[model samples]
Target: MSPTILAAILSVGVSAIATEVDSPQTQASIAVPANPDNETFAPLTPIAQIPDNSGDSSDKILEQINHYSNEPNALDQVTNVSQLRDVSPGDWAYEALRSLVERYGCIAGYPDGTYRGNRAMTRYEFAAGLNACLQQIERLIAGTNGVDGGDLETLQRLIQEFEAELATLGARVDNLEGRVAFLEDNQFSTTTKLSGEVIFGLAGVAAGEDVNGDDIDNVTIFGHRTRLELNTSFTGEDVLRTRLQAEGLGSLTEQTITPEGDLFFAGATDSDVVVDALLYDFPLGENTRVVLDANAGASDDFASTVNPFLDGDGGSGALSRFGTRHSIYYYLDGAGIGINHAFGDKLELSAGYLASEAADPGDDTGIFNGPYGALAQILFKPSDRLNIGLTYIHAYNRDTDTGSQLSNFRSFTEDAIGNAVPTSSNSYGVELSWQLSDRFALGGWVGYTQTTTLSTLGGQIDRGDLDIWNWAVSLAFPDLGKEGNVAGILVGMEPKVTDSSVNIPGIDTEDEDTSLHIEAFYQYQLTDNIAITPGIIWLTAPDHDNDNEDIVIGAIRTTFSF
Candidate 1:
């Protein structure tokens, strides 16, 4: 008979197509990047996640072919599924499908030879394939001496048998095509995905003392921080992230004269928007990923902070910055580059360098001449439930951004020794996380830094050394009250000067005695796009000095994400 009718009549056509066609891919779904430390916030939920395909599917003969193809992901969709001889049925189906593809150009699989992996095959796709076959046959019929009587009869019979299905499929195809067109015309940007977060907090000092030995005022204030991120991917594997941030949340530590209670969500920008982060990230080879920072890029952007569940880039994680991870990480900030390489699944190495004045070209204001931090970390995952990391940072004039002034004042001993002497430090840290169960997790870190006076302006004080230390442990309860809720408790010591040969002239000379930090927070996810957290932080000795009055802070924060 006719070539068109003959192909379908053969046992190969319906069965082979069903069995060989890779799962029809979904043109409907869009990809969202990763977590807060990566790109978008709120792990894979509604606005922060890819949408689901709404296509109707079934196990009918044609659908069976699609089922096999859908297993491979978008990245694997381009893989060539050429003539595979290892499986006899696969080999036969490949040859048969290839013939129909070349002869009629029907169901043109993929240009790269992979069947339309996971891209759903709609009635439109089927009708297009069918039309190609019918059109080719029509051209042949119009040719001289095209078909014999037997062939003509066979084709007519087959057409009469499937006429109803053909018409229905054609009408459905037209409708679907129109809908797809309208969506394409109305959808958001083809290359970029948008995500955003807004946090409103009512925070204040419940009790405390100022460093000047004055009773701290119990002032309460309401503030906010907002972030909007546009993540664009030129290539499937790389992403360029641009973030807009605005914050006016004031810190409770300002009233206590200690940095221990600095709220993670607080930033005193007075509601002024800024391009807070601009980073371009791409895969280097197979295992390495490189991050280029054009603006505010922190070490955790690429490097593993090793604190899971509680490492939400200060937006969704701990209430205080010190509870997020080891305070040593505070040194790795500013505009810089970060690189991560995976040795395998179990181990990874991350390194980076950041300079506060990288964008400045004025005298003594260039990258290397300004405050900077160089960091290296090795992370080991012994099991799915356990992770350990060892980190080191060599920095010049880098402050412990989240701790007390003894830790925060790294730029100079100028305030203390009267001379603006430069300082450098070497910081070491160890981090660990263990998942005790699906609901319980424990994480903590310890950091130590040795600071050395680099030079003196007037040689008024002998250049000596200072030793600083900080430690913390956190326990997390996941899905505590609800499926998306978390209850966290953290206890730690803020960065304090344990010893210093070089002395300060006016201040407490050094933070004396041990200061304990106790914090607890419960995050209740009200909806996929919203969460509320009420937390309390208590500092027994503000600024690590026992003489200072104890500080207690409370905050209720609400976050909306999209």
Candidate 2:
């Protein structure tokens, strides 16, 4: 008989004998040996006191069992009883354990060859051990080898009991496979994403006069603009962005001769699609990144403008161009390269160069020889609520007008001789914004430009050198009417000809006055991806002389984005 069977029979007999001796009804029928030492039988410990041998201690053994179970045909190389460190001749269950290891080939020991036998066993450990033994029994049965009939019957019963649970697990796995297949079939491009936006604007003007001093009869107009962007990434870290845009919006500056700067989204006069911008940016290291603009716009390659409340593209914040950022940002408008380096999250430096005629290769019009604008800015975020930027721009033969009323002053100086003369200028500006609280924010900017005409239009006609100054303060209330809503008011001087010395021979020409530009706007987010903004711009003294009627430009803008 196997040692396991022997131990089981002996254990059952001892328990019965002990129970009978302790029973009140049968105690008198039992007798104690006169001299216990003289008996040949060995004393047996209680079954509860016999150490449990299958729980955490069997973890290493279970791992090997799982491996062999997964590959049932794998060869079992362990064959000797002495291979295990803890299994020895003196062990009470050594014979049974050895038989299981050497004959059935189901048992495994720890990496160090130790067989821990005193640890408690859990039900899962018992199941794993039984499964290994069953596989060995099945091999013997299939080969018509010496396999016990009772062992085969027990294995068959256990398999039948677990049939329902096994079926449920298989069903769950099949469901997961279906879900994965569906996702793989319906997914979009792996490396590219698309986004788009459309804007509709209704605008009108009132109480504005022309340069001829006649009351300007401005008509109300409606316009629309649309944009679609595709963002592609190859390395997962770098991005290539391409944008397509179409617009039928008339120039906001076209209604008035005074050069009240253009709207932020006003450009195309026809509803023709064009490539608005294309840019590629990649990281150089942890803190630096380089940007290449195939067709860059003014704001494409700059760091934070420090005025988040009024910087959206006429969809959020203020609707006018001047209200978005300082005019110096408008100096660049074409292809360029930019570099930005961050000093932690609180500070950053950005620099870039852009040429208006970058694609042209004619005499004075190429990327290198054409009218080019170079900009450098240092941005600081002292706190989560405060941002500041110090900017400097140097442009050669570039137009300094940005549709704001101040642009009129700059344009007037350039057109002094009945022809526009190219000018070179160095502009310096400081912008700051502070979110004082959850509901309110304050922002402002001060800009100065020193311009020198480059044309040799003779002595008296030469406009010589000019100095322009512009500044504004803005007050904004976030979530004013509802969540995702904003209201803002801006008041500042338009670029003014603070000092100009045009040597017109006998006539001394200079602008001695500055105009005030006041604007107010409210943006209401109608949905997660849609917004409506109504705004009004009031220019006091459209001309430095204050002779022109106060200009009021009002517009209602609607935007949809996805």
Candidate 3:
């Protein structure tokens, strides 16, 4: 009976944690004029020619005016120009005249069929005309500024004046200059980005037995478990990353129970960390690539509270050789380098090796001597819709880590009876995936593993090996309202069955265990920069006698760009 179980039950009345959300403010309106006093507002119609009209010039002018007026708005009459009647004498017509000239070009008229000198433009009219002028200038600068004799100086001066007015109006267009640069280079360019995800979750056991194989007696809530990562990039082609994770046994209530029956809350410490990356981009052809990577850390596909890879970092699970609970997840941890490459549109290949360390004699480190084993894999994808893969691994168990140590966290340990046992093992597996459409996809993997153990004290033990498999499918909506925003759901599951044997000197037992896991996630985009995601996980482990195994996890996050 672990003491931490009781502590979790006591904290049931505690409040759930809260998350923060950021909302964007709507922009306020600004007032400016499209036509300034200094500009002339005129239609393409030529001066009503007196009898002195020259060479079809009148016809050409009329054609131009009719072409420009063909659209909804036309400058046939001066009233189409913006009005700024509040101009006081000697005031900075710098902004006023700029507005007028922008509206009519040179000369402007009035709505009464004449230019009204004293008619004051209301706030609404002023804002509309000003916005129109700004939009036109922006388009001209974007389209003509790079052409020969495109009046670059005029465009610059106009941009500066508009910017000044915008600033004075308290409408700060933050990073507008950067935006201009980005738009200017919209043709062919590359950008590198660094991003990461943080996950915090809680897990509870409804009914479960202990390591002693006792009848079901306790329900425990475990963890303050969290995962963190740091990512880096060089050019769009290179990437480097690091990750750290931790989980503890204690909380606001109590930690663990004592052999003599004491209550306590034993807080947590460092769980595991990893540092790794590709040395350089491996190019196979124009479009194919292959890369190499090396790293060390601990992780799990779904949950890590029960058995963390670096469990050696603390507590009773700390680095041990024999006695410790052995789970498939824990055995899968180790560092190795791998090769991944895609050729043309048809073939792809990948494979890697992992070396496991030895634990102290008191735990099941699966290590008999030095480094444990190695793994290799290959994958083929003929198209985006289909994929097939295979993997092979050879593992070595040592009797002791006394003579050699290959790497950190992966060495050999002795058994309880001082036996330096060792094991030689091999495993084979296959993988597959299918993207039925842009909105949905499915995937799965399966494998069979076997092991042979030999020891100076226990002779030889042959384990019957086991089989494992995982499957998943997902769907998403396209127009979810932009990036960071997604609508739809994802569902996945894994079913496991293991039939194997262990030969210990005094005890030999056949073990058969099975478990099933189901999970789902839904995401909602609140705005361009904010999103909310909610998910749930359910597990049924007959071997552990757990029921109603449900866990909830979700997050509210906001992102910003510079």
Looking at model 2, which ten-residue stretch has the lowest summed lDDT? 14-23
Q: Write the per-residue lDDT of candidate 3 for residues 1-562, one digit (tens) a residue.
A: 1111111111121110000001132111112222233443221111111122123343453443233223222222222223434333333233333333443232233223333233332222222233344454455448753222323343343234334332322232234456767866872324333443332222233333332334333444444333344444555454554444444433311211101001111235344433322223344555544433333422221112121211222211111111011122234344444445555556655544444443334455423344544445455667766766665656565211110111000121133334444556565656555656654444444544454544434354333332333233334443345543334333332323233344444532332332333333344445543334443333343222233222222222122211
Highest-TM-score candidate:
1
Per-residue lDDT, model 1, residue 359, is 94
Ordering by TM-score = 1, 2, 3
Ten contiguous residues with the weakest lDDT in model 3: 14-23
lDDT of 1: 0.69
lDDT of each: 0.69, 0.66, 0.33
Over 4 Å off in model 1, which ranges?
Answer: 1-69, 73-83, 87-179, 411-420, 505-508
Model 2 residue 284 distance off true place after TM-score fit, in angstroms:
0.7
Q: Per-candidate TM vs. native?
A: 0.77, 0.68, 0.44
Q: Count the backbone clashes (under 3 Å) in each candidate.
A: 12, 7, 39
**Decoy 3 TM-score against native:** 0.44
